[model samples]
Target chain A: MARWLLISVIYIELIIVSLGTSSVAQGGQELDWAALDWKALDWEALDGWELEGEAFAQARYFPDNPLYIGQHSQNQSLALELSAYRKFSDSFSLEFIPFYRHDFQDDERSHLDIRKAYALWASPTLEIGAGINKVFWGVTEAVHLVDIINQTDAIEAPDQEEKLGQAMVSLSLPLPSGLFDLYLMPNFRERNFPGEDGRLRGALVVDTNNPLYEHKDKDHHIDWAARLKQSLKDGELALSYFEGTARDPNLIMPLGTPSPVLLPYYSQIKQLGLEGQYIKDEWLWKLEAIYRKGQPNLQFEVEDYYAMTGGFEYNIYSIFESSQDLGIILEGIYDQRRDNALTFNEEDIVLGTRWSLNNMHSTEVLGLWIQDADSSAHNFVLELSTEIGNSIAVTVEALIFSEQQRNSDSGRFTADSIGHQMRQDDYLQIEIGYFF
Target chain B: MRNNLSNPPFHFLASILLMIPLLVQAETAEQKGRAIFEEIDRRDLNFGDFSSDQEMILRNKSGQESRRIMENTVLEGGNKDINDGDKTLIIFREPKRIRGTALITHAHQQRDDDQWLYLPALGRVKRISGASKAGSFVGSEFSYEDLAPQEVDDYTYEYIGDEIFAEQDCFKVKRVPVDKDSGYTQQFVWVDKSEYRIQKVEFYDRKATLIKILTITSYQQYLDQYWRPGYLSMINQQDGKSTDMIATNYVFRQGLTEADFSENSLRRAR
Candidate 1:
């Protein structure tokens, strides 16, 4: 009941903030672009286009045996990303970025994406942009609930940190109170799942060839979003709303299908999110909460729910009088949907620590432990990375899974929980990259 | 005797005679140090705003060297009524991997600064704790505390005897940071007498051991008033590592407003 009240208060605040008049349009001396003199602006003196790129190779080794046939114990992949940027004038610029990856096994794992391709027109008071872009929005170290702008590129990694490019037309207004942004998306992108031969997948693979959607327009449905973000002297806050196709798909098996394959079903959803953070000396407090409607439950019935993740990070600078900084992080997660929720973090605790060596090599280490509140299920992840020379960097990561609900027969494993589904997929990965 | 002491002329004369030594002592080393620093601060008071291109070359003990290039913009802020401090934006341009990365800082006079870092790869702007200001900046010998705008109240000063440095007569001043979080226990600063320009600085660690020495050179006057350094060299005396920072292409009074230094602009700092 208190959660409902808190959401209600936030809704009221959102209404008030949105209703406030925009100061950008209030200026009477707006320039008429059509009447502006173009010849007076020199075109020959502008700087030429610049290019940057990164190429990397990665290997993952699963300690536990594969749960299904065709799944390999070892996986290797290579990826490349290139970005081209150009500035036509002081207020106008263009950027294009393309990425490609190839996997030695699992053909579906190899993919290509246009991370960013956009033209931006910016001024002191306003900004307008349109193209394929990526927008990240959240303030949590664990699960990111408020970040809904892009589809998750799940095939790239299980950490959910990789995102697909989004096609959008955006407008930004910087006012005295805060920065307001509006986004219009005319198309939808589906989340790619791991292939049948992938290691970190459930017993039954998702039939990506055929998918279902609640909206009649399918991938052509129009979506919209808006956000109001402000940075205070010692804190920051953001209020956001998105109405579109849900990023996460619900898997269901139809009765009449010839094969018993799980088909992904995308449903429409409306999400209201709030993010805030405050810094007090060496401690940083963060919170991300959302109230989502029209999401499917386990029984395929649409339901409304609220979820939140709050955390704090305390920093110890120059530990032992050395050039190292250690940050202790603790966070709590709560979701009203409980068992029916798709994510495993319904009620969990996240504890993590980050250490930065602050040396010439820029070495860093991160360790995270997530525990299930009601059961003996947990996940541990550790990562260490450092730079070599001026252009090369290497990273090593390990993911460990522990669960008591693992069935003896992996094939007959039910859709009980994500932690139980992939209990045998613990793996260690290493990556090396060259940037130019 | 009491009557004589109470007499107006006698009392005034006695007080004047007694005040001679006290008056001479009034110009103590501490006050003189503060006055000299105040003069130094007053001379470079207002440039409004400036933007500059910088190159930092890092050299290790093995004599290996690496370079990083960046652009910086600083908005002068000392408005007590508005409670505003100096705002700075630094955007990295070189070392291809970290290109487009930016950092925005809001410095405060009496409290910890507020800092935000923008990672272009993730399209994320993260607020980092300012408690780590004592740490090295981007693996350079310069600490964050050294880059931050130095406010007069941030340190207590004591003027030492004059000395000659770099072929110039300089006043040596010992300054201890008022903030306990400072990496250095104390620092000795040398300022030339002619323009009150910083000539050299020696940093002493917590154990009163000299750790680093910085030298500023290539002074160029802008707007016929402000003296800006064209080059800075900081050497870690104990570690045998050093960093050379060369700043050029300074453009002052660019008419930059507070909006340019907003968090929203960090992603678009290029």
Candidate 2:
């Protein structure tokens, strides 16, 4: 608790310094900010034009948990991200970002290190990009929290993968009734294992803001996507489909006899998913379902998995009169996995509330209840974050578990199997960051 | 019931007689206003030589303002090929910080319009696109289409009625858009009856909202034949911003030939 308090004080001090200096500079006459001139030029005047470049900086900090019990200690880290962007034309631009980090903890194991980059080109009808970029899927605010997954470990859950290399292209074509967009992507890089070869993916994305049915008007819209996915949103979903040769198959087996080696080939592993969403004014509701076929080989047999998720999010306005926009989200997910080695079924109900306090401050609190056919568990998470200015943001998060499942005990045929035993673990993390 | 209704016939006749004069006055006023509006719409004002000083102010939603001063010179002619080519030069004087930037717009009715913008920072001139004559100059309330010299044949006008604006008796006229994709659905203008100059205009957006209001003030006649407004102010109701153009100097009857409005001439004008 003492250490957490110390980190919080330091974080607040740094923010005050940065914001005070920025405000002073802006108030002075040294910098000239010009308003846009609307009538000086003709139509198509901005087409094929480029603007001069400017430089900026950003910094952030995450503090330790203030409330917890038993061996409570906080982990804190700070990172700086620098970026530059240049527009070659109205349709094309290039961007570069570089980042560095430092952790306050004495142990080197708790430190963070990463390098990430991406580029994008956009036109009226086409968009293309390559590098380690983040893509979001699903439309529901609560159920799609899984889609908001970030690659950087310093900013996201420690267990999550931060970056992956991929190339993608998307094109939008206007149709008589509406518009149609097609997207294709191929991911060739992995974070923790040898890069997989001979694996490619594609998706068809259709977005329409126009009315689909005669009874509906332009305000009622829909977005749909069909994707060929080799990886799931969460790593837990990858436990299924064990066929297809791994780049390092030996990494999975016990270190004794020769690990089974399979020829490089394409194995059939497929999943079909559909999501429908309806948004009207302040009300939003969504339903989603996915089913995947398991792949099996001689050494290990994987499982088939299916899951359905439904949720609604409502923005509450009359609650806080000033500086805060609050919203409540409710979601439920049911998942089932069946295989020769094991069969597991689970259902999760999550309730969360998010508060956006002006442009500079925001916080979210979530409670998760998991009911397994074999056991039950509860998890609670709270995150508070704020953007100090244009360049700086800070976040602190805490996660607590009532009954946890460990990887070593989650499988079949063991005394410590997840079905027969239970354990609990709590994690607290703090991060401070700067960007330029 | 039939006997009672027949007893009130004399009272009904008295009410009808009372309304006749009111209706006649309304019809006569509309007729007089329409005639004046049609006369102004039919004549195309020819420009000989003109110069004016303008003050421009750019503001944001937060009510912050930036001001600029500019000078303009134009040599205009009619459709009879009297001055087939002529040039208009606009120069910025103050704030002295942006004094060296200039814009030269040349008009050639036979071909396309050409313009050049000269920047002091780059010390070079660049050609501007003519295809954008129908588009907004800068995300502003006035589009490039509004900046073009009003051609007599470009629009068909209808006189609506008489109205009082800023204590001036004005003729109200409605202009239907000829271009299909014009940002405005229709424009309503109130022209001063005596001066034959536009006193006020209400621009209706595609959504049928009163998006922009333009008012003309301080008029000065040039060369005794051309009545020019010294100040024109446009207020964007939605964005809370206004642009005010104020003319300071005037010169008439400058000899400018048609050859000056060509693209080849734009490169040489600077």
Candidate 3:
């Protein structure tokens, strides 16, 4: 079975390469280099220290939200992450990161997580690592269609930026045409969601513990993922394949007490992804596409489909006579399932802008709007962040959901879907983070 | 390593004689400015490649300050048909949250420079769009347009006469930005005639009003060829804010290739 998986991975990679060859025409300027986002912590207070890494603790709060509260709820959380590594030998070492969380709103949302615990042996041209880690792959900003390695931690944030750790044995080797990465993921992890009384909770309660997998091995299934990334003269191209259980679960309405419970069905899948982007002066064009041979939707039929997203970002510097920049981004998302697509972004448009103040405080703002083409459904998000003193930073975020398809004939088709189900989840979030 | 343009006419009697036509005939003020700018640009272009450590210290009106440390690597790009500009990569090392973040700049002599930002936390590379050149360089007083390799063609120069400033004979040159989208309308530069080094610069706003001033305090010669400044302070004339930069640890010719500045190698830049 491993041999078969490897063979099919190679075959699919070849097809993707062939299809991408014609489109890989040229390259452009690689500016956006040296760009600084002050939102990232700067340890100036501990400057000139010989340490090779950094650590930070942050706290988050929700000033306003339309949700029922539980006893002792404070609608706040304190989280911290420390990323430090030690080299025992010259070329071998260990990396461990322990993250802590405490949520005043929900106890289930607070827990200690081992984000990365790995031992690595690296050389000039080859590298090998084993343990739990997170891998990210995708190009576009608004949505990530090709990043499928880690399961989403929904309770952490709705932006899908939080990922659960995955255990794996990974290897990277230099190929003649590009760099190749091979992975043997030994454990399957299900996505996490907020509890009933927690903020950002879904309409139906999610049963994360009793996930039903297509394979009887359940979490013991040995999954596989491979990627070939080539750096072109003007741009970059990557082709990847993953044969594993799906990270996203299909919701099943199991008959219980009829309080609307969601049973997660984890299906086995074979996925192929292609991503490419070019950097031009004052503009960047990006594209991502994925084909999957498994059930990604609520229904278990057809067993095959594809989804794609493409967009470009243009910049306008020194706006309104200030030495700041405003970057405009636009992307169109499409899925083969079209209107029936489970993903809320299918047949939708993403319009966003990024503002950089270029001050010492690294003041920045990002605004995004996701609009459904078939209906008047839309999701809007805004994030504004700045630094306070040397070690502390503040960020404010607001989310709005307007589901025109709610409770009507047009809303019935969108009922229980991502956008409609999230109609009342709009919230205002404020976070003040301190770094050490 | 000085280019021919940097060699003043006073160095040779024959070259001074060649310039007699300009003084005696139709020598526009702009021509004189171009001549002086060419000399400054030539003296500035030395060394093949180098790396250094940089600190940006920002202070508000209240005198409270914040600092950032980064490793900067630069590769000269004139000989390979890329014109006489250079490529620069800056990696933030001190910031705990932004550790391993890298930014690349591909500067050109004729067109607008390009920029790419790599966020290590997200493991992603993104291109910065819009008039990026006019944007600030990481919240510092120095704008991206100010840090670019000031190629001769990117500006129109004029000789503003010579005077003794900073106790040295200096040529005051007025440079008008050729790029239409430049944040600065014009800049007044004072270069020491003997060393061809820029001593002070005054920036005019987009409306051609004086806005900021940059002063270079000290310089150190590396590889016995490149003259790099050790301290620079930029003051905003309108606001009370300022930024001071301390550049240190200059290592030249550690064998950096053009490939070293590419996005592929940027992941491990630190």
Candidate 4:
């Protein structure tokens, strides 16, 4: 299949080259002018379409013993992301992106997703789009607390940057004061989690096949969202609201069941989120806050809560008189429910520093440490990426857990103590990608 | 001495000597250099808005080559008091991985420019500090400062002399950057005396060493008043690398407004 694709690409390039040369050649005769017109039309047709993609191979190594049986300390995978875009006219365009990954260790890790398949019509004042799409809405770098349009593709990575496309119809209005966007999402997609054989799985395997929803419509329940963003002279403010099923599921372990597995429960939720970013020369202040209601807790009771992630990024450029930039990020995470919050970052601090080498290769390095305020637990992450050439890129990542001390008062394990559960899952990953 | 001064020829010489200081004070080197720059700026004004397609070919010492293609749009802003800088948006279409990526820049005359980068894959826009103007532009040999709009207030100028370059008489001028964060301390520019258009520039690093040379060629006239370069070549003397840039498909007076250059426009750059 790869060879066939290469040959087809070469064939198209040759035709384009020949057409270009012929168009530039003499065209004074009537017949030659007619041929030139046809060639120009063909050229326009070719110019309206574009195809691009990247193929990557990834490997991960864990130094510690696996907590679950059937899990390995080493894993490998291959993935491809291809996108094709076509401009029908100046006002309309279509984009289709298909992604696939194959894992050698776990069956559930191998998956396919359509990242984007959308048709859009845009004018000076309004834009209308339909089909499967991905939308992100947030400002804080530590975590995307306000973004809810797409479901998390958790199996892909731990950072939650990867998302599964959501089927929706969206509208955008650009006004004098700000930009307003409205979305009507019809189909609800479930999040992807690691299988039992995967290293990142919890103590009990999650039975994704049997998910329970609070609404009778289940996966067919319609979701709606809207947002208004305004850019000021030195800052930006955005207000967003979403009404739909919560992306974060509540895991329920059935009692007295023959198969010990956790069932994911999706609850309906209404959330109001606010995002702000203020830029003052070398310093950038960011904030993302969300007020959510009608989400159940571990006790299966509905609860209302608010969460916020606020921080500032200080950029220092040309350190040591070299073409390098250093940025320090300090964000504070807060949850109103405190211990009752479903996330591990109830009250935590994230301190990170990013070093960028403004060179020909575009090398960058990021280091982050997330420290829990109540406990001594901490999560350390490091990432480095660099380009080998115009088409090849390499990335390295490491995740480590340290000082995870379990509560001595309650000897039993609880769902809120995810940091303790992930203590032994430290791993190092490397990825090599070829782009075209 | 008194008798010589009383003579007619000596009196003429004395008057000329007296007038020499006045003439020097009337038009100093700095003032003449600044006037030339102002002329160039004035001729390029009133082009309300424009969009163009640009291509860059980067070559290493070993002769390996790579190509980058992008689309650029500019909205004239400095003419009015409310807007003191030009707004520019650039969208990349080549080097597949960076396709759909966009950059927006608000170039200012007396202060650091405001810039933002939009990554299409991540659906995120990141603000870049203006202090990084010396950074390489998309891994190319050209730096951000090299491409940014040049304002007369950003530098102090001195008229050097006149020289014949490329068979055309040109005026040589030296300019020192006013911003301390600038990578280059001074630069020498050559402008054609006839059209008042820049023809070549020599950049000197902070250590006062010549580092890079840029030459503009293939001049094209637009609207019967403005001259635009169709091709540019930048060579790095210290690195032995070079880049060739070609611009085409120019559209002038497209009726673009300030709204079109907003941050929301970055998302719709494609």
Candidate 5:
């Protein structure tokens, strides 16, 4: 009799709970962070087209350009990225992304290009793809030193996050404990650099159209890359090798240019990169190292060198009872060919932080400070991104440069050095993107 | 009934005699609760593998809501090793930007669970460290720990008592997580003895306060022997947030093998 009575009471309570839930479900509150209905939207607007605008201002100027060339930069730009995608079945798909940008300050920065045009076929354990595509490798937060698959899209961004897609046929096969990918790239694309009129350009501007190549086949030479990656329970590792014309061009002075103009020259190169990361509790240890042959030295010789970037990241969650996370990232980079390497971050330390507010807006902020070991230069960058609504995104970035240590840089960028060239180009950028 | 009892209960005497073995087998509340849990696990061990499409709806205070659709495939434990837990893959399909994100988890009883996240943007597999089980799943109320395959040895149980809940006879049990880094200190669960299926659970946070309450309903039996809940909803008592997970479809025995759950398959899971 007691059991039956309790059952009746429990049933009553459950009905009350159900009623309460139903009322709330039908109440006045609105949806937050809801997945915007992608299926209901027009396919052409949702997947085919995107529009973006950017505003930029230089905070400081290098002494040489404004006085001699009278170049002062305050610029606005518009960009459009068009993508076409189709899926025939679970086994086949196609994608194409073409972007066009127009900059008011530099006409060279305004152009149309295709980033990717790829077709893919996949089985359960194997996949094959062909056409122009972008592939990224490495696992470091501060600097992606080992991600060398694609040439940089110089005018697109200063952070080196954007790339010009490569044309290749690739295959990925599953290993018992890892994944192996093989790529046969038949087209080589030279890197593009900012023009003289651009604020972020080097002191002597780069000639984008004209370039020399060590290989007689030049841009036609086929390049190849292979990677084997394994994912463990709490760690990951990858070994990748690339043989092709160097993506980073060596600057050579042309006969016509009196000012030390940089003519891009590609050289033969072979690189082997190893990347791995392991996580322990709240701390993550990341490492990326590469050994390369055929990087042009100071004497324009194919010299061999090694470089590495290692770091750790630690984060604190639910800060101050709010669903936010603050993460601290630290990494140190060292290069065996201190001044002969392609990048300016030789023997440097990077300190950065990431802030993520777990909110409906999906807001995030990242700031990084990279300082040279000799205390000659400092590079500081800050980026903040958030969604404006369901279909738009807004981002703001600031790049600041400190005093350059004259003649301290050991890299191939010795003439202008990355520090001095960027010192006067310190600028703030604001960009907004509409997805549909 | 009175006449029957007047005979000193021939049926009652036999019932008491029948209870002797049970009394011997379960001396304490903890043992009895553990035995029931282990029995349920054993009965559930027969299922080999299954897949389903699911939608997870999250709501904050003031009734604001957000929804995400995903597909999940789970391989039953003991199909390979008796001590091994289930292998599961969750593929996010909706919220367009995060589409094609796949998380594969291989749960083990002896050590930490292995997890891999295949990022569509990066086109690479990322290891979500074992220690990250305490973190939330895609910013939802459910943590990786909450969704992990339940192994009998992962928690210790204490029988709270028998009670009628949801119009059915139920066993109330308190379960304390044995994993040192568990976000919850203890959880109180309601299980219906008739089907040996979970009906409700109340989660206590690290501070041992009631943090979340989960209620399951719309149970449908598959293959005549497997009872699968159609919907599971969790409400955060402290934050007024909630998550409702509803399974839309299910397919059993697709001939999934251990290789299918491997990290290499994650990138191809779509």
Candidate 6:
């Protein structure tokens, strides 16, 4: 297993080196050089502190969701985060962030993760960085299935199963027609158990501001990304890739087992996304689509998978003089799995409304119906969020889930068929935050 | 009884004569208050050649005094286009900290006005948009719009009533916002009994909330004809910030021009 993992790690590194060198040769741009104007870094341009940070306490209670492992299981979780950033100069600054999350049920564990801790050197045409960072790639509202090429979460989950952190160097260049960003990261495992291997990662992301109509001045944008694991936006797009292996591919296997250990597989994921939004007076409409392939971690089996997702959202405000806004969302996903078995498909419909009582207070109600290969569920959520003062905010959420189907082990029903009968679950969450 | 019925016209004339004194007294007070209010308006319109010294105390939402400062400046004209070929400048001299910083704003009667802010740190001037006038200025209790020259034609005013303010008789006038986008819905002003100068003005937001209060104190006669408020303070009810404008020097000169209001000229202003 160790040999297999080592081989996989080496292969990934070779691929990354070859791709990065070729792109660099073709583009003729140095990855480590920083070309930023220092005069742009005047602190006075920011004026009034421009310093903001927030801390919050949140609790979630989930009851009887079809995706749970057992007949019924409930979990409670708590999380806290703090962040601070100050501009030393207009083009350079230092930022620090510390975060912690603890789960009370089941595993009963806690983890502290640094979401962002770095110094940034930025100019109108370039940006350079060092430390923990996040990259944004897609423009979808509900679920950005195509944004998988980057190292950030496109889904709703606040925690990432893969703790991906690396010593990274990035560069941003503004082209005459578009923006190009690239990144190069070296892998150093802080906690890799035996039989697990780790390697370097790199990525590139490109965004083009293009307009579909001649009369409109570029309301639409397109993003393309390719990476070894995932890279954030504003890095490099052409000369970037990821080269890393799973930490523990053979968790419980003996040291010298004859059984072939899961080979560390080197994979390259690529993504393409497009988005357009139009706003006329009080009416807003948006449409987005994304496509992703070669997601190794997303594979349920030994083979890789690909997914394509698209969604649309519309908002109409003050339709009846009640200061009310109506929003509707629709999303669809197609997932191609390995082994030519158990393909995943998802479709969702969401309807929501927001009522503005004043500038400082608002209430929202949302109804969502999600259908997947194994189950279908309906969720109704209501949220009331208000700013009590300049630095204090409170939000309360009530959610009720209705599972329409249950999975059975009789082999008489397929996973897709069982998903049709999944029934409902319920949950509640509340959060209060303060900023200074 | 028969003789009284025949002389009914004479009896009615006597009754009319008796009511004249009461009517005269009511009319006189109204006339006095209106004159004072109009004089205050005129002085504010032609506000030039006046200066004073003042101190401002700012409190936060937690009822803590966050800052205190003393300032002095000279006022030119209250017209929005005072710098437009008029060459009027309001120069600050005291408060060692903010000394030499000038706020140069050009007002236009019908269109949006332009403002130039000169900061000591940058040693350069920045042009600010007129759109921001709707909000509070530098966290002060008064909006930037309130600090600018207000055209009397922008609002239709009504003489509501007479009352006593700060131990002095005054006239209460009501003014409504005629601009559709004004953040304020209405304003109530009180004029002093003797000087025809505004003593207080209360501003209400669109939601009918009392958002700001302006009080004028310490009056002085300029050019022996124009009465000017030596000190003026505005308190923001929501944020608890206050701004006091004190005049320290007064000079009357006809040496300004409209050519000075151009954007290019503002960048080159000394």
Evaluated with lDDT, which candidate comes out highest?
A: 1
Ordered list by lDDT, greatest first? 1, 4, 5, 3, 6, 2
Write the number of the candidate with greater TM-score, choosing between 1 and 6. 1
Residues B113-153, model 1: lDDT tens digits: 88889989888888888766787787788888998888888
Candidate 4: which pairs clash? none
lDDT string for model 1 (A67-135, tens) is 787799999999999987777688887777889999998777899988887778999899998778889
Work out the TM-score per prediction: 0.89, 0.43, 0.80, 0.87, 0.82, 0.44
> What is residue A260's positional error in candidate 5, in angstroms?
5.4
Listed per model, the TM-scores of chain A against the true chain A are 0.87, 0.55, 0.82, 0.89, 0.83, 0.58
lDDT, residue B220, candidate 6: 69
In the order shown, the candidates' DockQ scores are 0.48, 0.02, 0.34, 0.29, 0.16, 0.03
* Candidate 3 local lDDT, A1-436, one digit each (tens): 3223433543454456444432332222543323322232133212222333223333444444444443222367778777656554545655556677777667767767666666667665677877777777878888888898777776777888887777888897765436788999988877777766576655676776677889899988989999888866346689999998988777777875556678788889999999997766667889999999877564545458899998998888777777687889999998887645666777889999999887767888999998887778888999999976556678888888876354335444432266665666677778777666
After superposing candidate 6 on the true structure, give the runs of residues whose Cα lies further than 4 Å from its correct spot.
A1-57, A63-76, A84-86, A106-109, A149-167, A175-178, A185-267, A295-345, A359-376, A386-394, A404-425, A432-436, B1-270
Docking outcome class, model 6: incorrect
Could you say which candidate leads in TM-score? 1
Interface RMSD after interface superposition, each candidate: 1.7, 17.5, 2.9, 2.6, 2.9, 13.3
Worst 10 residues of 6 chain A by lDDT: A198-207
lDDT of 5 by residue, A1-436 (tens): 2223323543454466555544554565664223233342233233322222222222222333342253565667788766556555767766666778887777887877667667778777788987777787888876787887788787787777778877888899988667898998888878877666667765677776779999999998888999998866567889999999888888877886665677889988899999998877677889999999877865576779888999898877655654576789899999887765566787889999988775545578999998887565888999897754445667788888788655653543453275666666677777776654
Better structure of 2 and 5 per DockQ: 5
Query: For candidate 2, lDDT tens digit of each residue in A1-436?
Result: 2223323543454466555545654786675233112332221233333222212222222233322122124334444444334455544554333444443432222223223233445543445543333343344433332231122231224323343222334343433212333444332222221111100000111111111221122111121223322211110010111111111111122234353322221123355555555443344566667565543322245556566777776655323322234667777766554222221223557677766542212233433333433344555667776544333445566655555433334354321132222132255545443332
Cα lDDT for residue B154, model 2?
A: 44
Model 4, position A430: C-alpha lDDT score = 99
Instruction: State the lDDT of candidate 6 residue by residue for B61-157, as single tens digits.
Output: 5564322232323344445644321122333332222333456665545544445455432233433333444544333354557766555655657
State each model's CA lDDT, in order.
Answer: 0.84, 0.45, 0.73, 0.83, 0.75, 0.45
- Give me the overall lDDT of model 4: 0.83
Supply candidate 5's per-residue lDDT for B225: 81
Provide chain B TM-scores across all predictions.
0.93, 0.72, 0.87, 0.91, 0.89, 0.67
